[model samples]
Every structure is written in structure tokens, then in C-alpha cells.
Target: MNGDWFIRGRDGRLSVYLPTDDAVLCRAERALGGSWEPPRRLGGEQRLRPGPAVGQGADRYTHLAAWRPTKPGEAGLVHSTHFRPHLAALDWTPIGHPGKTGDRTGPPAVAVDARGRAHVFVRNQAGGVSMRMQKEKGGWDPWRDLKGGDVQGELAAVTGQSGLVELYAATPAGILHWRQEKPAAVPTLEEAMDASVRPDTLYALPTSATDTTLFHTDDSGDLCAWRPGTKPTTVLPSAGPSRVSAVRCELDGHDCTLLAQRSASGRVAFAAYPTEQESAGAWWTESGPQLPADALVSLTVDEEDRVMAATLSPSTGRLLISRRKDEPGLALEAWREV
Candidate 1:
């Protein structure tokens, strides 16, 4: 499974959730680029296939949601819990199943709105979407169907500046559909490509209060982005068939978007999309450290805009976490495995 489950806490620490043989493992760095705590198991005794979804609410608690097999040979069920950042130990609560029995498709995806409520989204077995929200008084609401037919991949959720939540899902026909939580809002479809794309890896970047940039890799292996009312822009020409992660950050005092993915040669590489004033070109391609080949990588930015990357080695299936050292320029030497 791809390493997409991660969240940067309000205190600037980075935590990642990974699936193991019998449990879900969580590893956290006390601070960006700092020493990491030992892995803590979070419920699940059966095999957890895809990774979990994690989000931090305004209340300073990090929420995690995931699905694990019900039995050795059965389908999976969804579960959730929240933990305090300063605590060394965890107390996981059971947030029951979001989908019907034998209906879970991918792991859950979560987004905490400004009201401090956690919203969880999951793809059902029938290729449709379902969601559940945490109540202000504490328990979860009943599952609500979002009802997108033939939804092709994992759902992505983000709360916009107006405190409105939006969701994105891909279709088998390479169309990206989005819906807003506000009344009178309906799902809007964007034709991202003419051919089918990898629907499982859709990512939405809320660049501003009113503007969001959606990113996804097409079937042809190109990294593409779409802003409201604009055509899709190709960010990386050939990101095909690899896991891609991106975050908006400041690079040398300039607002930029950083993208990390496994290169065509199988090694992990990073590129930068700096503001016009910071660069004459569109992308500073191949800027970060050289990492091991065939490793699945996940990228995130801390409160200070420093990039943290977690990589899973293909040979041993072990995870190695790294961060960019505080430096003046973007260079391979600036990244150190921690």
C-alpha cells in the first residue's frame, strides 16, 4: 500500500500511520527533523491492507480512521479514534463501521472543519461514497451517502477558507467530481483527461480561502493540476505509475508547491514550483535528496514549511523517515535521513 496516511500536528510534529500484518503502526517525530518515537499500535489485530487517514482538529487532537479485515478471510470494517499530541500513550475509541457489511473499498479519509468536527469519507464496495461526521456533543452521526456512481478511487476532503468542506473523487472515465457541503451545492464534474486515470491517488490543495488546486496522475503517467474555471495544468510531465504527494510551502521566502514522487528510474525525487518572482522557469525539477530506488514515498510540510518525507523500502518493507535540513538553498545535501 502507498504511504499516504500522515498529518502534521498543530505543534509542528509529524505523525504517520502505516499498516502492518496484524495492527496499524503509528510513528511520530517530536519536532520536524527531530528524533522519532517508537511505533505505537492502534487497534486492529487482523491484516490492515491500505493505510489509515489522519487529521488534526482545532481542539488539538489528531483523529485517525482506517479499515481492517473483519476476519482472516473476510471483508473489512472501518474504525476511528483520536489522540492528544502531547500524550505519550494513546487511548483509541471505536467509531464503528461507516459502510455496510462487506462494503468497504479503500481506507477512510478524514478532514476536520473549523468547527472542530471530524468528517470521514470512504469508498464503498459498489464504487460509491459514504460519509459520517462527529457531533459537537461527542459521538458520530449516522452514515450519509454521497452517492456518486462508479466512483473510481479514494476520496479526498478539505475544508476551504470559508469553513466549507469539499470532496473530490475520480470516475472510471477520468472525470474528477467535487461537491460542497453548503446548501444548494451539487457535485461538479471536471474532465481531467480523455482516458482513464489512476483514481486512487487524488489530492486537493486548498491554495487559498476561495481557490483550491486539484492534483492527480493521469493514466499516461503525467502529474496534472486543475484550478476552478481553468484548464488542467501539467505539473510533472511523466509522473506516471508512481505514488505522488504534494504540499504548499515556502521555499527561500517564496510561496511554492513541492512535489515528490518516484522517478522514472525508480528512485524518489522532488521538484519545486516556485512563484514567478522566485524562478524564471515553471519547475525546479530534481531538487531534493537522492533516495533508495523502489521505495514508496509520502511527503508533508511542517509549521515552518520544512518538508518531511516518509519512505517504505521495497526490499525489507521497512520505513525510513527523512526531513530537509534548515539551509539557504534547495540541494540534495540539505536532506538528511532521520
Candidate 2:
């Protein structure tokens, strides 16, 4: 769940969202755990895109957003929330395009803050970014322009270590970032952080209460980690992959970050390292069967703290879950089709 395709609630059950061509489908762990119920379709009319970006708030609510066709050749964003886990999701709310008329925008990235507000960011047609967010009174505020130029692809948003919302967008120039000085405040664009990154490959993870680490593929196609104001450090050398999904979890009692990527040939690969310790080195291991190149993959931690990986089977188109083996390093159980 690059935008957190899956989220764990206070009850410790996992809920996952999938954006098929026309609608968003959902599945959740049974209340007692051990299995997932059948897929539940969250209705939408327009043809949808890849992500139904999801973020969980302090209230334990999971907010979901996605981009869809507003009209022929026009795209718009829609959202919903899982206020009560395992229950039906709320109705879809239309978040119109940034332009007065229809306009093109990239897939959404959502971040729910400590105060329970969800901030949504998208790359505007003008190569900058625009945002629309939920209001305090339970409705949405009008789309706001957080200016930028040279922004290339999808945006990234994360609630920073201080409970403030921060955003990142890859650009030919560098990675453009925006930060809220205070909670619920408008995000201001900061100095561009330098990185020779590919568009749509940027991902952010809060490494500490005050530090955030960025993961992206460099010009050479190597995955690199960069803390703002520092040089980018290679995490995994180039393997001809374009994107990756990551999650933070405890590994062998050590705080670790796990990464999963679908290779160019459609096989899933995994790697891990101590959180924020890129200098400690890391290695990539390709495992499991090959999936469709278009198939998206995600990494998440189960309630037991074991890393779990998920993807869709190309041939059967069924959802596949691979749980981490208990004995050691990132080995996975047989791919289970649920």
C-alpha cells in the first residue's frame, strides 16, 4: 500500500483497499483474525486508477482516496473513510479537479494527522501540486494550490514526527517538498532536496520523531536513501526496477525497515536494513513466483510484528498473501490466495 494500501486498526486487524479499473474493492481480516472475508466493492462510477490511497487517523479511522475519470479524458479525485473497521465504507465524496473546469492530476497521496484531519495531495496538470483536505466540521475544504514547478509525477504525504503534515514530489530539478509549520496549517514549499530520482518512485518514512527518510531510485536506477540536507546513500543497487514499497517493523528485536519491489520481470524481491542505518548495508533477495508487470505489491507488518507481503496473481487475478517465516531473515510462507 504505497499510500498505505493496508492499515492496522487499534483492534490489530488489517484492512486492505484495492483500486480496480472501475471501483475500489476492500477486504479485511476477520474480527478474530486468521482469515479475510470476501471482497467488498466500494462503489464508484468513473474508471479508476491504481491507488485508493489510504491513511489512518488518530480516531482510528482509515481514509481512502483515488483518482478517476470525471469525463472523457478528464480526471478527478474521490474519497471515503472506514470509520468502523470491517463495516461498509462511507459513501464516496467527490473532490473535484484543481482547475475550474476539468483537468488532469496524478494519483493522490494522503496523510492523516494527530488531530484526525486527513491531508490529500496531487500533482496538478501544470507540473505543480494542488491539495484538498477534510475540514474540522466533517466536510472538505476547497482545493488549495500549494505552488511548485517542475513536479513530475505522483505526490507523497506523511504526517511528520511532530504530527505535522509533509509532502514530497519528484522533479527534474530535485525533489520538491512542502511542510506545515503547525498541525492543520497550510503546507509551505521548502527548498528542493537534491536527488536524481525517477518520477513516481519517491516514498517517505518517518525514521524518528524529528527525522524523515526518503527512498527513491536514482538516475542510475539504484534505490537510495536520503535525509534532507545530506547526500543520497545507496540502499539497494540497481536491479532495473522502478519502484518499491516499504514498511517499518521490528526484526529480531531490532527496529528495521523492510522493502518490497516487483522486478522488471515480475518477480517480487525483498530487502531489509536497520531503520535509518543505511551505512550498515543491505541486500536484495528475489523470492516467490513472477507476477504481472502491472501488478502492484505491498509490504506491511502483522499484529505479531512479522512482515507480510501482498500482490495479485497475474494468471488467476486472485489476491496473494505471503507471511514471513518465524525462524529468521525475510523468508515467506507459501503464497496464500485469499
Candidate 3:
């Protein structure tokens, strides 16, 4: 029932998020200033970049991009996200759409790099094909219409880390990856691979090299952790039921990690994840046994780096900072009675 979290600013200041709208809010004192009012609704002509892929960069200023909808029926008439560097404005001007939403062939996702250089990953209506766009200071590079594969969900990044290491799902199949300069395509398809964990296995990553990917699958109920780079499966220490729903970056000076899942265990709960596997050195080396009551409906990190927050709505479902585990019989009741 406690919905509060804090963050450390670039100037060694602490900012806090108090309960407000029914949205996982993003605050950038450096960008938006100290104005903590309701999100300023842009002209209905403008919409958020659409998806969790939007992020704040490392520039002196805050950054996000916004684009106008050229065609009809697009998710956004104008798309906007944080800020970027080198790029004229974090905003974008579109060309055209492929066809419909809910289809593989649509628009590409807009993502920015550490310096705020803009890059996009998407699949157009052409069916069997994919696309990527890079934006320069003045103009943009040609769309490298890639035949690699379809990008599922949205995109994610960490400065120069996970952001550039593209992750997507290859239809009728599961997770795959596309790094900055490696082979353009990932190596798996709809092939049923053996994952020691299942259900809530995927997670909002934090640049871990060991098992960079996390997802949910019904291993011991719902489990979450990194997918083994060598094996076509997830390497999770045996843990009790747990599910990681949403995640946010809590800045401790220059270091950033994650605050996942939520717990009314009376104290804000957290688990440490090494940026890489070897970094995990025997951490979660064995799946720590927890239970399903660990599932989440939705949650976020506040200014103080505290893993505090609650449902966007008392009826939204569960917010997880870990893997999907058996619920400890706690669902969204009401803040008045948790």
C-alpha cells in the first residue's frame, strides 16, 4: 500500500515520486525541471513514444523524442520520448506506415543511444522483413531494411549497454537478440527450447552479461532470471514462486541497478543482479526458493531508490520485480486493507 520511491540526481540531489496518476511516471528534474504536476498532456496530436523503450539519457539536458503520425490508425499521431544528443531534437518526422497494428509488418520502435543518437527497430507490412533507422545530427541514415526478423514488444537499453543490444521475439517462436555489431540476427525460432525457468521469465534488464535476458516461464511455478547464453534455456537459481513485472533504474551516483517486484513483507524488497554472469559469481548461483505470492501487478522506483509503488489501478493485476511465482494469496484488494 506504500507507493513511494526516490532517485539520486546528477547533482547529488534526491527527488521523490508521490502517488499521483494511474501511470508509472517518469521524472527528470534535469529535464522537466522541479515541476511535479500531472503529466503535461501534449497536443492530442502528440503521444508518448509508445512502450517502455522510452528513456532518459546522460546529456546535461533531459531527452525524449516525439514524431507526428503521417498515416491513419497509427498508435500515435505524434510520438515523443525523453531526450537525445547530437540529434537535432529528440523528435522524429515519419515517412509512412506498413499496414495495420497487431501485425508483424508495422512501424519500427524508436530508441536512443547513450549520447542520444536515435536508432529505430521495426518491421513493416512486408511480412517476412524487418527495419532499422539511425538518426544523425542533421539528417538520418537510410533505413537499413533488415531481413533479420520481427521485433516483439518494445525495446530497452542502459546508456550504451542493453539499449543497443536489441532484443525481440521471432513470431510463433520466442526471444532473440541483435547486438550493435554482431550478426544481424538471433539464432532461435519457434523451436521449443528447454528452459529451467518459465512463465514470468523476461525482465526489464540491467546490462548483465551472464544471462542478459530474463523471462517468465512455469519452472517451479513462475520463475525469473537470465537465459543461459550457452544453453537454449534460462539459468535461474531454484527460488520460491516469484515474478518480475516492471523495473526502473535507481541511480546511486553513476551506478544503476534495478528494483523489481513488490512485497508487503513490511519492508521494500530487492535482489541484486550483476551486470554480467561471472559478476554474479555464485549469486543466485542456486535458484533461491521463494514462492508465487511474489507476482506483481505493476510497480516503479521513485527518486530515493526505494522499491515502493503500487497498482496503477487497484484492479490492474500484479507488478513483479522478480519472476512470476505462486501468489501468497495476496491480490489487489485495496490500499485501505493490505
Candidate 4:
């Protein structure tokens, strides 16, 4: 399970920090002038993607992708985890089932293009990856498996005005991707109009990164920021004098602000830093109070700009929601039994 992490909204009225199972858990708080309130869960189940993916606009919308374990009488469900994804529409509308039993694919993630369409990227059974688009008008385009190596831990993001959906997939061949045809066709399920495979990137991956994200460092020796593109940005140099321990970043308007925690092994300490326009550090500078030792996750921010974080110690089952206190303001609120 992941602890808390942050992201800002289009209008920045809502700030979110998600901490949940293998899915994306969006916890939002409203920020008017200053003070903020405790965070609460968003609608529907978490994401089915390897991590989490979101699309925020007018009010704030998100996508939670995940892998569910199989229960009794379940056959194909074994290898394939139950995938449940929703678009933050007036009513949460589900996409489609990501994988089948024994399916070699990992999880599937979708990005909303400039045209209000959803694009899905997934790796099929034989270790091959593919892209699919679904239009707002109602219809899933065909799935075009991208050519090349085996893919896992898939992710994607649509460029602001360009309408290009940039895709990122962890692969044995290294990080992989493809540029969407600006407002690309809604991926079709039709037999015709299929996609041709294309290859990109050829770098070896660092094994320590079970999940990969863009990051940087600062003068205080704290690491922060991520210059995430529709594709993978350059990774931090593994070899460093200080030894980068952690990183954090959240979407802020047109860019991102990353934070990090760094210290010697067995040492407990924390620092904060911002990614210069150039994302100028080994990572993002983690700010605020220091987290308890043994916490396994990083920091997260919401639309209100308030930051909250959580982590479960392997030795103990504890869930913590610690957020920065700001000028309390009015916010859209909802609650239900989880």
C-alpha cells in the first residue's frame, strides 16, 4: 500500500493527497484564503493502474486503477487482478476490464486527451504493450498493441493544450512510450483501424525502483521535484555523494513542485527544497515536520495546496494522515462507508 502524496487541481481550489492500497487513493481538501481542513476520500474505488493517474478540471475529477485478488470459484482471476477504473463524471462511469486470468499484463492506466476522450495503455499477455482510446460520445476504439519488449507498471498523461497523451510503461526493454495523435482517435474495438507497433527508448532500468517517478535534489541535501512529461524524463544519477533517499512532486498549474527526505541509513532527519525551473536538484526538497522513522512512503499535496502524508510500518499496521495546517476555508464535502 502507498502512503500520502500530493497534486494540485486545474483551478487549484482543491488539493489532494492519496494514500491507499496498490491503487490511487485521492484525498482532497479545499483551500480558500489560508487555513485547511482534514482530507477525505474521493468517490468510487481506487485506480487499477500500477500507481495512480488523475484528471482535474472544473471541480476536480480523478482516476483510480488497481489489481484485485481472485476469490473462490475464480479461475482466470488468479493471474489477473480485478481492475476497476472510473472517470469523475456526474456519475462515475467505469472503463473496461484490464486483464484476464493468467494474463501476463500488469495494470492499465488511461489519460484524458484535450477532447474529453480517454486513452488507455496496457501490456498484453506475450509481454507486448498497446494503446486504446475511448471518445466522449460513447465507444471504445480498437486496441493497438505497441511493438517491442515486455512491459509492466504502465502510466500515461495527456499534454495540456497539445492534446497529445504521453505514455510511460516500465518494461524489461526499459521505460517505453508513444506520442498520441493530438486528440488521437478514441481507441477502437472495431477490427479495422488498428494501430501499428512503434519502438522508443533503450536504457537499462535501476532495480531498486519497484515503481519509477521523475525526481531531483537540493543544497540542503534534500531531494525534490519531478519534470514529468507525457514521457519519462531523465532519472537521477544513482551514484551520488549524499546518497538520495527520497523524492516528492505534485502538479502545480503548468508544472510540478517536488519534495524529498534524505539522511544516512539508520539516521532520522528531513529537509525541504524546490525544483528550480530547471528541476535543478537530485530530487525535490521534502518540507514541514519530519516523518517517523520506518514510514515507507513520501509526501502528498491537494488542490487546496495543503500537504498530507501516510505510511504503514512493515512491523506495525499503522495508517497516518498528517497534513499542513492552513487558514480553514469552505470546501465541497462527502463521506461514505469504505
Candidate 5:
């Protein structure tokens, strides 16, 4: 599973998309401060590695993309959408594989554009990236190749504050980026980054129209933060080598960034600091009970502006959530399995 498992919709309701052993399941809040609906199976047989990738557009429709086995040892990508925040979603639509044979494609990475178009990016069988997006007129576009030879593991994409889509892929030497010069336009390959990034650990935090801060683990297992045209800086030296889940929230009348990850000791660790102020530093706090080795944590700010962290129960496959306490500092309420 990835950090996108928990998402807040435009209507202020939150939804959890879980990739189970047999199918993709979803549970959503009925109202603000209300109970969550029982898990609803969102059709897909057999889980693919790394779970489903989700994104939401300006229209508030949450888009989901996942890989499912089409046959023995073969898989294909499929998509679905929550057309309305508190309603049933549209049926899953098949998107197929990028190559003529084999499931060598990496996990799907989704980013919906400003015009409400969902664009899915994947590392193709050729060790390069390929993209397929939704057309404005209601349909799908053919897969287009965006070349990069050494992409490894998962891919990342973000629709920036400028309303243009930017992509990042981890490689053996560093990270490679692609940017859309205009809204709804093709993203051309930008300069390649020289920071040594750990596989499947890339997270893009959009700070400005043309600037995005990328967080990943370095060769030494320390957390590093880097923005385009800037040198990579070590933020949390001991932040365990795991996928970083981050969100921007208002704390004490100031804009702050919240990050969560599985620590080296199996506990979920959290940290916060003023946005883009990594040089000033942040104090990592280990919180919650120790999770399973395969557990992935997701962070999101709720309707009340409180930070929430969620992950699946390793034994029962149930949803467990922990919200920030209503007091000073970054303390959290007890974990609640809702």
C-alpha cells in the first residue's frame, strides 16, 4: 500500500481505499465526526504489489488506479472513480498493460490535472515511463511513452499549484523529473537530479508553481529533502528507510508540514516543521503501536483540520486510524479502529 490509501474529498468527507488479499475495498465517513460505512469491495481479484494509486481533481472526484492479475503470472491496470464524495463509485474500467506482454510495469501513479482529467503514469517494461490520460471529451487516450531508461520501483506525479502535472521516477544514480510547461500539455523531461534515492521511497511535495520538494531515503538510510535547482539536505537523519507520507496543515496559526513513516524499530514516527524550512530542522516523534513489517501509513488532515494517520490491521485487514489530539504540540489520540 501507498500513502494515498486515505484521501479527503471536496465535500470534506474522508475515504479509505484498501487493497485486500482478494479485492480492493473502501470505507468512507458518513458525515463529519460520524461513523464510517462498512468496507465496500471495489472489484479486483488478487492484490498487486504496492497497492492502489489514488488521486483527486479540482472536481472532487477521487480517481483510483490498480493492477490486477489478468491471468497466471500476468496483470493489467484498471481504473475507477468516486463520482461523488459520499456515493457509490463508477465501475472499474480496464486500462490494460503498457507492453505487448508481461507485467513488468511498475505500480500505477495517478495525478488528476486542473481540468479534472486523470493521468496515470507507470514505469514501462523498458525501464522507462509511459502515461495514459483521460480526454476532456470523455474517453481515454492511447498510451504515450515518456522515455527514461533507469527508472526503478514506484513512480510519483503531482498536479502542481500552477495546475500543470510534474512526474518523478527513482533511478540507480538519482531521480529523474518531467514537467508540463502548460496546463493539460505534455510534460517534457526536465534536468535529471543527482541525489541518490532509495527505491519506492520518493514523495513529491509541491511547494510552489515551479518548485516541488522531494523526500526520499539516501544511500546511508537517512531522510533527504531536495528541491529542483537546490542541493539535497538531510532532514531527519534517523527517519527509517520507508515511504514518507506528508500533508500541509495549519498549526498554531502557522502553515506547517506533517510527515509520518514507519521507523526502523517498526513504530510509526512523525515530525512537523514550517513548510520548506528543513534547514531549521524537525524533531522526530515515535508514535502509535508498532505495525507489521508490510504495513504502510497514510496521513491526511480531516474536515476539522486535525491531522489523522491510518493503516490496515495486519491480522484482520481492518482500518485503524489515529488523530492528533486537540491540544498543544503534536500529540495524538489513541488509535481507533473505525
Candidate 6:
């Protein structure tokens, strides 16, 4: 899980969802510098893993997907839920499982395409990928298998300019495989990339309507990015062993990408690509407060271009959410326990 569970409503308010002991916690930031409301439980008993995927559809409703164990020490399924942000309080609709019963991999990857349909991807126990889509009239379609090689890690998905969804997953041997799906079509695994170095975590960011950039950390602890026509470029050397999250966003009216990682040293660090000219050099790195030794970091950008990061502290068994300050520079403020 490496992305935010937050989505911005059409009215500009940001809502973030986190999973607590046996419930999903919901909190919202009021528009126009208003503070965040007190946390409210969304009402579910299954324990949720960090890295839940969330997207705002054209209908102005927020959709979310998360994985929870069916039983202690058993395989899990990916579940879908949604809410209308305009309502003061939310009752999450149980949208049912988007994956099969044996699906037991990482958190679901979700994205709302141009037509406002919600698409979700998860790994099945068979080491293949499964996909499900929201119908025009509202319910999800049956899970469709997107066959691939033995995928050992989570899948990264992003909607492309043409309304096609692209998926990326790394094989156990460190090779990356990608595929694209159009509306009402099955996806086929295309050619694979030769990434000899395996990454502990991987993230993908769509840089434009037609292009996307893949970011991952090599075994040498370097943060690297792979573009369409270029070789893998080391964005930051010595990033340390950690999961990396990235989002394509704007900074001062310019297109940029934000990268966040919790290094082996227990420090949460962030770097940004402000512009094309600054993409090759050392990013503006800002180190945040120390995290728990076993903290898992997930990063996301809200509708207001504010970067939100959630770290699950295993020591306290608490999930902490923090927002980057609105200043011009890439400075992150302190974390607030949710």
C-alpha cells in the first residue's frame, strides 16, 4: 500500500479513510482553511491493510477498495465501498468483492477512468491478476482474469488519456510486466521489462495523458524512474530499503511528481521533480519525523494538490496521517495520529 486513501470532492473538501482495529475511519477537511473533523468509524469488522485505493468518480462520489483477511491466517478478498462527500455523515455501501475468493495479495489498485467508471485490480492466489469494473447503472461486473506470469508483489494501476487502464506488476525475479485494457475488453500481458534489480516496493505515475513513469527502489537502495523511451534513471541515490509512493501533481502551476519513502533509518523522506529541467538532479529532499521501526508508508495527493501520507505504526498499532504544508517549498509538517 503506497497511495492515499483520500479523495477530494467536487466541492473541494478532502476526505481520508483509514482502517482501525475493526473499522474504517473517516475524516474530512473543510473547505477554505477549515480544520479536519473528528474521526468517525465507517463500520466494518474486518481488519484492513494500509494502501487502500480511493478515487473520486464523475458522479461526485468517492470510491474505495481494500483487502481484509477473511479469517485469521487465511487468504483475503478485495472489497469495494463508496460514499457521497456532500453528506455530513457517510454510510459506506458494501459493494461486494471485486476479486475472487482466493485472491490474497496486496491492496486493490483503483482508478476512475475518463468515463467515470471505477476499475480495480488485485492479485489472485494463482499469481495472476484479476480485474473488475463498475457498471454504468452502478454494481460491479464479475472478476476478469488478466493472466500474467508469477507476480509476487502488488500491482500498480493508472488510467491513461484514452480511457484505457494500464497495469504494472513485478515478477518474483524482478522483471516488470505491463498491460493495458480498454472499455469492455480483456487485457493481455504485453512485453516485459528487463529490470534485473528487484525492488522491495514499486509505484507508477502517469505523467501525461499518454505517458507514465515507473518508479522503484533498486537493491542498491537507489530510487529510479523508467520513462517511455529512456533507460532507468536514478532519481535519488541511496534512498534506502523502503516502499516508495509517487503521484503526478502540480506545484506553483507547473507539473511535478512527488516521491515519498520511509528509509531504513526510520526517517520519512520526500523528494520532488519540480520541472523537466530539474528531473535529473537531486530533488528537494525534506526529512520528516522518525517513524516506528516497522512503519509502512503510503503517500497520496488530494484534489487541492496537498500531499497526504499515512504511516501505519506497528509498534502502537496506529495509523498516522500527515499533510504537507501549503508553503511554496516541499516541506512536510508533523504527523497527526489519526
TM-score quality measure for candidate 4: 0.52
The number of residue pairs in model 3 that clash at the backbone is: 83
Model 5 lDDT per residue over 1-338, tens place: 54377888878888888776546778888997689988876643435544678887777678888887777878888888886556777777888788855764777889988898999898898888988888888888888898988899888888877778888889998989898888777788886988778898988877765688888888888888888778888988756767888888877777888888888888888888888989878978988777787677888888788998987764577677888889887889998878
Error of 2 at 164 (Å): 1.4
- For candidate 6, give the lDDT: 0.63
Residue-wise C-alpha lDDT for candidate 4, range 161-185, written one tens digit per residue: 3454555444444344455443564
Candidate 3 vs 5: which has more TM-score? 5
Lowest summed lDDT across 10 adjacent residues in model 1 is found at 275-284
**lDDT for each residue of candidate 2 in 185-274, tens digit (9 for 90 to 100):** 889987687768898888888888887788888888899987776888999775446567888888778899888888766778888899
lDDT score of residue 181 within candidate 6: 57
lDDT for every model?
A: 0.62, 0.78, 0.35, 0.37, 0.80, 0.63
Per-model C-alpha RMSD: 3.9, 2.3, 9.4, 10.4, 2.1, 3.9
Model 6: worst 10 consecutive residues (lDDT sum): 89-98
Candidate 4 residue-wise lDDT at 307: 53
Q: State which candidate has the highest TM-score.
A: 5
Q: Cα lDDT for residue 265, model 3?
A: 41
For candidate 2, the C-alpha RMSD (Å) to the true structure equals: 2.3
List pairs with backbone clashes in candidate 2: 1-4, 1-5
Per-residue accuracy of model 1 over 1-338 as CA lDDT, tens digit each: 33246667667677766666556677777665577777777653444555567665555466666666565544554445545443543444555554556635766777777677777777765667777777867877777776766776567776666666677777777554555646223333333444445777677766776767667777776777766566666765654366577777777887877777767665566777762221233442453444466566777766766777776654454666656778865543344444
Off by over 4 Å in 4: 1-5, 17-26, 30-60, 68-94, 98-104, 154-161, 186-286, 292-338
Model 2: lDDT equals 0.78
Clash counts per candidate, in order, are 1, 2, 83, 50, 0, 0
Poorly placed runs, candidate 3 (over 4 Å): 1-35, 47-53, 60-92, 98-110, 126-129, 148-164, 182-201, 208-211, 218-221, 232-259, 262-311, 314-338
Give candidate 2's error at residue 255 in angstroms.
1.4
lDDT sort, best first: 5, 2, 6, 1, 4, 3
- Tell me the tens digit of each residue's lDDT in model 3 across 133-242: 43435444544544444333333322334334343333335444444543222222222333443322334344444224544444355334444354443333333333
